[model samples]
Target: MKTLGIDIGSSSIKVAVFDAANGSCLASTQMPTDEMIINSPQKGWAEQDPNTWWSYFVDAAKQLSALVNMEDIKAIGITYQMHGLVAVDGNGSVVRPSIIWCDSRAVSFGNRALEKIGVEKCLQHHLNSPGNFTASKIAWVKENEPELFSRIRKIMLPGDYIAYKLSGDITTTAQGLSEGILWDFKEERVSEFILNHYGLNKEILARQVPCFGHQLELNSEAAIILGMKEGTPITYRSGDQPNNAFSLNVLTPGEIAATAGTSGVVYGVSSSIAYDPQSRVNTFMHVNHTTKDPHLGVMLCINGTGILNSWLRRNATKGLSYIQMNELASQVPAGSQGLTILPFGNGAERVLGNRDLGAHMQNINFNIHSTAHMLRAAQEGIAFSMQYGVEIMKTVGVIPTVIRAGIANLFQSDLFTQTVADITGATIELYNTNGAIGAARGAALGAGYYSKSSEAFSTLKVEKVVEPSRNPLLQEAYGNWCHCLNQQLK
Candidate 1:
């Protein structure tokens, strides 16, 4: 009567149970009384204990059981942060702390591997640079900690680790492999070129499994711990982004999904096999991706939006709250009176050719521009950056007609949302859903409760809709912003 989905994230473990008949969330909650700590033993490194993730999962299962009938759960699914490296020995015990998605320790390894593989060859086959992804992290281990590397019987992504814990099986989907930069899209298999380059063998990698099939059945040990029936099949698994897309029904080509958090991402799904020469957006396998029917999630990330806004709040906003800031800025007419603030102050942006054009506050007139103008310009700049990235996505055939996003993060800002919608000329639909809900829907579809993928989104609630008003001011601001960006690049 219900399908369960667990989102294993860096921040927390979110679990949701979905009603099979109506596709509505029956129960959902995130565990861990506090945010899980990301240990940085050294700067630019992020790691977490895999055992801690399992503990949170156990706690979440216990919490969910108290809220709903655990016996009604017919199938299971998992979604998690992408590009993490979890290694285990033959005994299936974790050998090291997980090198999470945000870890930069493997950057040099990834860059060196790319040079060895040749840029064009890597883009052509790997569909990505080996940069800071799972394989590169593994390569770092192999070279930097050879003794530790030798003991790693197998390596898997974050979600795969959770699945392994539940089912006592080590397997992954092609989608998972692709996110880890371990898949050869051209060859449609594990990248032997990378393995050979990194001096690793296929034996250490998890076996490939179907993304929407019976990946594995729950083992007695995990079942008893979680108060669930043993042998329950886990039918779906994916990285958080792809699963978030699926949750919003952005499955087929031309459908789009966007998330604006510390980093802003616009994921557009398309059937065409394409790659950006500048690597503005990374391509990953969508949940429904197949060799026969290619579903590519062309992801465009603008590394600044929320972080820039937060910085402004802490330092520049003086005493105004975010709501007050939004209200005040809403009064300022478009273009912020010719003042432009480039939101790229966060760090190097991929969309801008991986350049760190250190957040320029340009064309400033201290007399003319007030705090309101700065706020408006900052929001517009962030929106323009998204518009800029989406333009790059278009170069690879990912033009968004409708952008879907959760009713969270910067999308919560009417000024920000309207700016993005108007500039891109796309209808923005805000959904009251998250990654766990999407994985739950995926679970039902995989369990054959829904005949088609679209049916799974029947109860997906749309909180609001922002249709483009053809706002010429936003267009003018974007043009002005782009000109300034071009000058900065030169």
Candidate 2:
């Protein structure tokens, strides 16, 4: 038995085929050698065409088919970039380019909704302000583009749109709605209050589906395009952060998962209904959540993380490979000898109260500091920014004794991983897994191919463990970084 997992990311589309019997990945590949472009027509706006994602999905499926028999794939799972708004017409054609997660254009609408709905009511029922979420984005379209809004038949998240293309079903998960600020935690359903406030009809939203269930099956048309057998069930769907936690087996409370991709996120699982009073760290339903066994993922996200490193690689380092950059960064001492970086340039960061402080590099010395110092400073700054969010997470009872992460992206850097461990004082467990692999495992569990949920991760293994080491110099450096951040905030 086999399962196919597709992870729809902002950068690219990744597909992995997993053996259901052993949880081993048979083949994996990503489409587009370069990162997919996020079209920015105006400042603070980020959009991508849903058809572009479909095209990449088809391309990736063709590549994977070359490696294995597509007919052998029994089930499919989808994990996607969260909080995006994709509107479709009655014929299932996209109405507009998707307004993605990092876009800050909807901030004002979210703030207005927060005030209109009352902060306490929103925090108690929704667990977050409608800040830059899908609902707010839809509201933006309603107010700004009335014609487009009137033509919308269904609104879907990024994953739901992809699934619709595959199965001809417009559906979304409770977790997906929650990430969009459309799910009412108090009622455990869609938020009519938010919808009314935004002047949206409930009919615009996609039909609700369980995160793990027999959600939909591949149709003949999709099968032909994907080069897969018809009737392959897509059993699981989730936003990337919750799915990231699921990928690392961090389903229970006190277990935490961290990832540093284009953005940095620390997701901690908790059973109790909790919310940060300031609405800094957002909470949503975990992939394994249920009415009886409620699991909430408290997530702290830093908008700028790996992108800062990528910027340095492209402009500063002159196209150095990530490995070469890491090697150079490792050579520098901790603290980068007084250089500091604040990686908040990408967009409005949720951790900083939706503040767009912009990226900053403080205290540069031309005579003493080299490109190696700049590289190390960028990594340390990102780790410190995450530490800042983790501190806020601690306030909401998400104190992490250890953090689990896949051995990819920024975690691939020893210096970056060690810095995070030392600064946060949490043991870092590196896993041989990614979002695509996790979705595949989730598919097996959802499709009943595995007898138990634990059976789905039978092959998940810890590749390495990095314990926090006592280093006063690094501690002082972190303190310095914090000081710089505090000054900028003030």
Candidate 3:
């Protein structure tokens, strides 16, 4: 049997087929042959049409089906960009462009929530301040676009929207609610406190389903459009970061996962319920969480990572490819010869308490510094930012002695891999797994094809391991980077 996993990412749609027996990827493909568009109608805002995601998903699924027997596909799973708001009317028509995760327009709304709901109360119940999360995004809509809010019969994250399209069902998992800041961690259910504060009807929320269970089934209309069989159960769905952790076999406490895509994330699983008081590092329900076991994920997100790399490539590098830039960066020494980069340019970073300190390059020397030095500093800056947040996780008792990452995106860069390890004093493991494959395995387990989590990820393997280099020089360099970052934040 095979399970299909679809990831509706901020940049593209990726689909994978995995062997349910061994948890190995059978085939995978992404469509458009280019990145999807993220439309920003105004500064600090990010939006995308839900229909565009569906369109690419259909094309990618049909194309993946042609590479194998469609009959062999047993189930479908979806992992999507988290904290996005997708509103649909009673007739299921999209009410407007989805307010995506990184949009910072709701920062004020979230601040109001902290004041009105009381910061202590919010931290106690939601495990973080509501800070520009999905709940605040909806509140923004209700305040600014009252008419649109009136038409909204349902609100969903990007993944939930895709699942609804596939199954003709409108529902969300507890994990999804956690990402949206809608779950009350203390109560282990949706937060009536927040709902009452926002004046949002509990009925507007999707029916809550178990994070990993038989949650949805493919509809005939979706089956015909995607050329798959009807009634194929969508056994699993999760936010991309949580799914990335699940994909990395980091299910148990003390196991940690990191990903550097358009954004950077460090997700650690813990059995204990904890919250970050400042709401900088958000916590959410893990995919395997249950009322009985109570697993939660402590997530640290940096909005600017690869996007800063892309910005440099577009504006600074002029025409050099990323590979060329990497080669140039490799020529520079560890510290980039006193050059430093602050990569918070993408938007207001939650790690910095939702502050929008645009990207900056410090200590540039016109005569001494070269592009190679700037490139190296950029990569190191990203790593330093990650280390900064890891410090917060350490404070909250999710100290990771080692970090696991997939061999994709920035992890594919040797400089980034080593910098992260050396700076944080942790070993870094790179595996040959990605989110779609993880979602597939999760689907198999959720659909009861596998009886245990270990059995589900038995075939998972590591491709490489990076140990922290015992170099005082590198540590000192990171200290300097941290000092510079602290100065900038001040």
lDDT of each: 0.86, 0.92, 0.89
Candidate 1 per-residue lDDT, tens place, 1-490, comes to 6999999987789899988787678888887764577787975677999999999988888899999988778999899988889999889989899998767677778778888889999999977777778998999999988898889999999999999999999999899889988899989899999999999998999998899978899999998998889999999999988887888888879899998765688998989878886576889899888899899999887767776777788788886777888898898998898999888764456677656677889899978998889999998998898888888888999888999998766788898899989999999999988888888878888878888876777777789999988877778888999999999999
How do the residues 1-490 of candidate 3 rate in per-residue lDDT, one tens digit apiece?
7998888898888899999876678899886676778888889999999999999988888888779876677888889999999999999899999999889999999999999999999998898998999999999999999999999999999999999999888999988998898989888779999999999999999997777778988899988887778889999899999999999988898899999998999999999878788988988889888889978899999999988887778788878988889888999888888888888887789999999888888889999899888889989999989988999998888897889999988898998899899888899999998888878888888889988888887888888999998767667767887788788889
Q: lDDT of model 2 at residue 483?
A: 90
Which stretch of 10 consecutive residues in model 1 shows the poorest summed lDDT? 346-355
Say which prediction, candidate 1 or candidate 3, comes out ahead on TM-score: 3
Measured over all alpha carbons after superposition, the RMSD of each candidate to the real structure, in angstroms, is 3.1, 0.9, 1.3
Please report the TM-score between candidate 1 and the true structure.
0.88
Error of 2 at 235 (Å): 0.2
Query: What shift in Å separates residue 234 of candidate 1 from its native position after superposition?
Result: 1.1
Ranking by lDDT: 2, 3, 1
In candidate 3, residue 132 scores what lDDT? Answer: 93
**How far out, in Å, is residue 195 in model 2?**
0.2
- Candidates in order, TM-scores: namely 0.88, 0.99, 0.98
Give the total clashing residue pairs for model 3.
Answer: 1
TM-score-sorted candidate list, best first? 2, 3, 1
Predicted structure 3, TM vs. truth? 0.98
Off by more than 4 A, model 3? none
Q: How many residue pairs clash in each candidate?
A: 1, 0, 1
